[model samples]
Target chain A: MMRWTLKSLGTQIASTLASAGGVAGAFLFVLFLEAVFLGESKQIVAYIEHMEPDIWVMQHGVSNMHMASSFVWDWKLDAVVEMDGVEKVTSILYVNTMVRAGDRDWFTYVVGLVEGDKRAGPWAMKSGSASPGPGEIVIPALFAESSGAGLGSSVSVADKKFTVVGLSLGTFSMANSVAFVSFGDLVNILSAGGTVSYGLVDLEPGSDAAAMARRIEAEVEKVSALPHPEFVRNDFNMAMRMGVDVVAFMRVIGSALAVAIIAFTALVQVSRRRRELAIAKALGVTNRSIYFSVVLQTVLITTAGYAVALALALGVAPMISLFVPEVTLLVSTGSLLRMGAVALVVAVIAAMVPAYMVNQVDPLTAFQG
Target chain B: MASSKLIRADGVSKHFGTGHTQVRAVDGVSLKIGYGELVLIMGPSGSGKTTLLSMLGGLLRPTQGRIEVAGTEITVMKEAELPDVRARLVGFVFQSFNLMEALTVEENILFPAQLIPGGIAAARPRARELIERLNLRERRDSLPKTLSGGEKQRVAIARALINEPPLILADEPTGNLDSRTGQEVMMILFDITRDENRSVVLVTHDPRVEEIADRILWLEDGKLRDRKSEDHSWVRDPVCGMRIDEWTAVHTWERSDSKYVFCSARCKERFVEAPDQYVNA
Candidate 1:
């Protein structure tokens, strides 16, 4: 039987892997951008959802927590507790601002609540407690290290100084660190009295959280309430939506880059076999049949590149977090698949130019001495 | 169309461009070849030898008139249908020993079998037979690049015969080989023609091959003519006394407005180093 493929099986595999290396470079660039851009939302959503509150009530007209602020009077908590399905209500003062520690400043999401409250406390800690005493603060260990402060060290938030009593993990992201301080201390810092940023509600057994949410919104004059999953989804979408236009624009740019890479590789591969292709054409191999092999090679290259990109992205995230602790990468399955689809599109488009070149090839070229 | 005839061209013409830039590559040429005939098409450079061969083999569509290979009028066939016709009935051999670089001798021989019914597997016995018949049994597993010139041409002939094509169109089949190897390749082609009853249409400028051809068609200025029985203008190299077909000669030098053609680059170089001696001779 005729050997219809590459010189040998090893040559075909080596060619795919070698071409994938070039394709993988393009995948890596786009994946890295996604990690840096959406990394914060990934960490923040994970941190919040881990607390697992039944419902959250923001100040009136606020649908999400990221990049937005809300204020609810402390009396709103009173009104919520009196509702039909009310179990308990807890409050936290939230602010997104830069915290100055010594001479350096780091942007942070500051959460202020009573001591021993887990409703909006650090989900994980490296040292000390989530319940920082009044006049004390809990900062992500990563942020603390960068600020050159650790447990028992002094730090300042919103220009008010507090002793660092706890170091947290899973609270540091690419954009900002989540820092905690006492509710009264935050109130003193903000100089606002008798009001909190948001109210967290827990449902009693057999209570419909969504219905309770609707009731809270209806009874309370100035408030927006949402179920736990809904709140988490909203915050994730909003936080990640910060530079969405850029994300969309980068997606186009990245896709174009991938197309060019694959196209260039396909073109080079086809060009090397000009004589062979012409011979095949003269020998009665239809252009369509030839394209089957070309496209197969391109798709293999693209898929192999995706596998390489996934490995590199996953492998690099932890290394990056280890070396540069401030930056975390979120290589989600959804986005990876999206990029993979883009790779497929790139593979198809890449095959076109070379395939056209093949179509234009004069089979008479085989006769060229 | 006649069943006894393997190829018949009815006033076929191929023009390159329209209007002033037009090149009348083959202008209204007509011919017929019976089965088991070995005909040679010889011409000067740009004489449309390849173009005519391309049309006859269905590798090209004539701009005017018709070409019939076996019983089918190929010129009128749809573009997509021509490839199957060519694969089923026509086999091609080239001067470059156009064996696929990536394919082994046996693999190259069986390359066209993919288009036939039952595919390459069905043609394996024929491939082995051709390999043994062409004296390539030991080299069946060797790639074209690893083979000598004569071996490559033998592989090309074996490949041409693998599909059992009734007509073989060879463009300068022996142009790149030394005289001895060229004669060996020509012998194989003649053997295929006589023994298998296949017709061979070959285009070449090598005058040394004229002795073996059953009939010779001389092409010049885009049309066949009976001006000279000699295939093409033949010139002998002063350095080696080897005759070179001046039309397709790649090793040539122009001095004092006179051209010198050599059979090989070394002879050309020797002449170039001392042009006066050869010119005087």
Candidate 2:
């Protein structure tokens, strides 16, 4: 029986792969896109590690990075630091700056962290040293690679020349590339000598984050205290609002197409095997056995097809990454399990229609000349 | 009395369609086939011989009346239970052979036996025995499509005997074979019935089959007439010496003071030319 099942699986693989190449191609493409865009490569949480702030304080009406605007007075940090349960508070400046490396210039978000604060500065520096002195800068790896500039190289941003002193691991954000700079330097760049963009607050161990946020919001009326949880939620919301969820959409479409392909294949197979099924029924095979065999055949086929697709996807991952530099194909155990579950569901649904046909087959007609 | 008849049908009528358009396929068949009897049902086309066989085999339910095969009234059995009854008591061979093309000869033979109440482990030896008895062991693993007409018919016979059912229902089991092959198949079927004490109800339009039957039933227009019981009423052709029934022969002759008959014109001519020489000299 296993040999027969294997033969059936082989036939199913050949037939489905021959006729429904588009579905398989599309499924692999979706997996490739997921690896590149939404997978570990686009680490939103990792970028936030540089701030190291237990709480963020933005303007009262600010929602996301691009959609909302906020600029609290620089003096607000002093009052925030004196609040009960406040450990320390420092000012952070964020601005979009275009840096020129060689002849080509690209846009990136220059984030300002306080000097001498290891918890809040260039957390994932890959090369060179962190805490770039007054005129030095830390560029993300993607910008450095694209701009063809490395450590000790001079780059210009906003007409201010600075030497590239280090490289960070995480590259671009969903919105833009992030470059770490000193808060004092950013103050000079944004104000030409004035207040910063937002405040970064660290709370004591026993502090209630929500209550602290409310108190901070009440105290600093001009700006709002954005909790860490809300900040993460806003980040995801912004990504969704900007149509950066292409990976998720591709996954859905791939799943639907896989189901359709399996269903159509099962239907065609059942139609072809109608006579054989009828003969089996006439020969006294019970209705239950016929149904079970049809479903078993479908599940066996789908399992084999999914295996082939997964192997092919893994083989082409590097090629996909090379062709589409922005995307990476990360085939983790979790993703494979997800794909297997999807294929199993598709197999069951696909087999149901044909199994129903088998159940309805009249055994008497099988004996007819 | 006669070991309580293996099959008993009472006023079994099967009608197709409705109202004025109703056609009675097996109008009202009431017959009993006892154990170890090979009964041949002979009729012309559209004479309802196949329908009667189907009713006897539990393949079709009679429109009205009871059918008892192997002590179970099939008419009272539910649709779900019909297959079990058929598998346990009746093994059917169709005119078309009805073998699963995808399965091998051995698999087809083992199919019915495996589906019976017991497990396949209990049925495997029986299936092997039947396969060997039918001389199909050499081609057991070969698919039905690769077998010749005669070989396929023999496989079908093996399948019918696999479960060791008390009764065998054959609908033109040799309909597609040549005369020699047909004779060989009939010989095997009759030998099985006589040797194994199994009852057989064979449905056919050909009168040549009447030779092997213990009792010959004549059906005309969905009704059974009386049984024919004349000894030596059918004879082998002198030229080829193949058994031919008197009703279907091109020429038939009867001997004086004896009801015995000879098959063809040539055989009768030869017998008449030298009466004493051919008779008893």
Candidate 3:
């Protein structure tokens, strides 16, 4: 019965195409928005999110990494490292600036990492080296791709030229392309004498990150201490609350329009085939059977639409990533599962009115008409 | 065929509305259809032929009356029970050949049988046999849109018999077909009544149906008009010449303690004013 009903409706290619388009379009729009949110959240703190820091110390009011600037006096690192829970401490500086490469200027975040300390520094490298020596910089692969910077290329920062010596992997930024500079060069550029961005403290074995963070907060004044995970979460929440919710609003609008399109298509299909349903009822076909057939057809349509939308998203994701290399359109299994559930619920809801209409169809109408 | 009543309707009246707008589509109708009887209900449009058929088939409940189909009192049966009754006992063929446009000829015939328990298993073989018997083998997979009017009607007949229903209800089964095709369809129905010993109650406006009917039942203004009064089941009024049902007659006269019903109060008054003139005439 489902096959027959679908085939009957399938003959009207124009309407079926329109319906499929509506379903697929809705799915794709929601997916795009979801991907953008994922991208924004991931890129908000890409530099420090996956660092080996157990406790992250920042200025008292700072919650996000890239959006706000936080600084601590140089002596705070000495106090934090001396805490009993601390294993090692690395002081870092976040310098948001623009770098000029020949005719093009790229907005970039230059992170200053402590010399000889791998913690809170670029650990993964695509080429050259993860650490940048004096008068050298480690550019992120996304920044290199976007700004046409390569190994040994000279990029001018504050009218001073520095050679890109390494390329880091997957350390892209939403606000700007990211690069790593040495502590000496960073101090020279920012004129730092007694100020640092924050201190990343690694906890000793079996030491709790939260406990160490509490210890640091107690000893350090004018600074806030948070566990690394909490810091990452704060960054994500800050990003969402600031502006990324617009994507969520777009998703809701897309879903409503999608529901309308699917509902209209289903209503039109059921209405057109009402005579056929009445005929089936007269032939001893139960109302449940008719309703089941309609619902089944709708599920099939929605599943097909989801499949098409997924294919389109997968096809477009890489291209989108290439265009905006700083942030990636993240597609994961969890997101796909969420999307599948929404599509199924939409399909079922859209079918309800049509199913009830089929149930109310009088069998006698078939004979009389 | 042994004579046995397959359908019994007692004082059935089906009214559509309330107050002055009430339309009595089938009023005070009593009918008994025997097995192997091909009863054709003939009436003009809006004469309640279809309405009466709908009531008998349990598709519509009567406003007042009792209907027993194959010994089951369908009138008092719950609405939920009607589908099973319709599936197991009553098979319907329609005026438009109402075959499901989505399904093919074979699926159409197999549908009624599939409604019963373990029906698909039984219906498969029955469908094959009926398809071959009805000469629809070549069109088994052809949709209703692809079949001719005669072919469609034949498929409908095959469907009606697929469940081996004891009673079949057809409403203008050949109204859309040509006269010769209509006759062929009627003959198929006649053959089912004769060979399978099934009862058929058909509603049609076509005069050609008269040839196939074992007994022609007439309906007008929602009331049954018997063609023959030999059994005195329906009495013809002396003045109006209209058949009056004794169970539902509102106007009647008593002569020597023998009751006689009149078609209307005006007819009853005219008959009482000069009973001898009309009774003798």
Candidate 4:
């Protein structure tokens, strides 16, 4: 029933906030990197993977689509469609190029969709239909805002002009974006009349994708087959590998900042108020009780700080998108939990030095004549 | 009967360090303090008065011999258990008015109740009574920094009595106050002995408190000594070599378990500035 008033409560609150701010800064930095690196890869995989394909057949020696190029002879599709359990084969021409809209340009992965096919095309459209006929294009919904181009606008790819017939959804990220165009236009742009970029194959219901992919690789020449899930994983890793070390280093720096702030605050708390601790000890409060209170306060403050950091990140992302429409901050719960774990670590380490200093307080030294 | 005594010490001695550098701070002093007695332990600066008080209150264990408070042997108890004993059997008041600066007067008064039964909630009525009784009701919501020295000491006294400990140990309770305020505090402490029917042991060099005390224990060179009223002699401060009339000297000062008289504030300040230089010389 005793009301406890800590003189350092204000300092503790400030320190907790500062530490949490450091952690949140780290989280945002990671999100930005993921948006640039992993975020783009995620879009790349989602574009192809969401077509409900069981296997991806690309040119040999090419494993992913984030940075690699792939091509197979047009004759390879005949053999793939003839294989057992081959429900359907949708061939799409994929190329990474810059699309020019008016004066602005963006690095775009242009997926050339075939006529009368839904697979490997924009899954959802903000306007118009999912398919783009020859001389027509469909860009990700956010790209329209970034490029200042919308439906009915003309955009150029590979120096070839095409009308934007539709705006696609779930195909945009800060890293890169996807644009759908007519198959023949891309083939004309590439001037390769007898080749296909990727052959998306769907399997019969209840068929094994990995086994079918293996059968395709063994039976076909100059073409590699990969299970859909494995291809997505490979592409994600390939994209993130460039920024992985930097993201990790930034995380370390952020955690260090949090640790430094919390530790220093606790140190100041004890050094400045040691006599108060001694006075309490003199009045018969046990060392255990005093220490328990110190540690408990630190943990509570650090936890509150982490919550503040999460709110800050979630709150700031949308505000940023207002100015930079193409920028998507991938603030995941997994990353927040990682920082929360770091905050907990900071709280424990911060409490030790002060608690130890408090242990040295002699009540007899508190009296002065 | 032994049961009537609030505190009893048997040949207790406290020594610091060892060999050539060893210092005997409290040298085998034996004493008894009875219930409801206001006992004043007066001594020169280095006479072990604080050390003796520490031992009696269970703040420090005697190096030799044993101490019993409220009939419980404390010197033999383990170091870890001393705090509980001190909290339950003793209340401490210090010269600095060591109140937590952030807590209001009422909260400060109830701070020690955490170690006692019923905690702060149960001690609220008693805390209110103490605040009203000590004339601190007006400053009940004020922090220590906002209160005057007199008020701070009153809050400390109230804090000391919150747990209703049978014994109150005060080390230089008036050392930080002006003479008038010091006298006022001494009167309040004197009242606590009668009003609470408890024992109050105060360590001070203030000659003003001699009349208010039931018994006076004078210590010198870590040992308690007996004196006769006619044995007065003109003395120079051993440290400063300044002659002063014991009755009228304003520079009478306590340091390092010994007391001295200086001719001027300069001498007292010089002595305090660096005692080792003067005492060693």
The candidate scoring highest on TM-score is 1
CAPRI-style quality class for the chain A–B interface of candidate 2: acceptable
Second chain alone, TM-score for each candidate: 0.88, 0.81, 0.79, 0.84
Interface Cα RMSD, each model? 2.1, 2.9, 1.9, 2.4
lDDT of 2 by residue, B67-185 (tens): 99878888998888877877778888877888766678887787777676675678888878888888888998998879988899898888888888899988887666656677788
- What digit string (tens of lDDT, one per residue) describes model 2 on residues A176-204? 56677787777787773456666778899
Off by over 4 Å in 1: A1-19, A116-119, B16-23, B226-281
Ranking 2 against 4 by TM-score, winner: 4
lDDT of each: 0.82, 0.72, 0.79, 0.79
Model 4 steric clash total: 11
Q: Residue A111's C-alpha lDDT in candidate 4?
A: 87
The TM-score, computed over Cα atoms with residue i paired to residue i, of candidate 3 is 0.80
List where candidate 2 sits over 4 angstroms from the true fold. A1-13, A16-37, A50-70, A79-90, A95-108, A113-169, A173-175, A180-195, A198-252, A312-319, A329-339, B1-3, B19-21, B205-208, B226-281
> Can you tell me which runs of candidate 3 are displaced by over 4 Å?
A1-14, A60-66, A82-87, A95-108, A113-169, A180-192, A202-230, A240-244, A323-327, B1-4, B17-22, B228-281
- Supply candidate 2's per-residue lDDT for A265: 72
Ranking by lDDT: 1, 3, 4, 2
DockQ of candidate 2 (2 decimals)? 0.28
DockQ values, each candidate: 0.53, 0.28, 0.37, 0.42
Which consecutive 10 residues in model 3 chain B have the weakest lDDT in total?
B242-251
User: On residues A279-350, what C-alpha lDDT tens digit does candidate 1 reach at each position?
Assistant: 888988888888876777678678888889899999988898789767777778878989988998888988
* TM-scores of all predicted structures: 0.89, 0.76, 0.80, 0.79
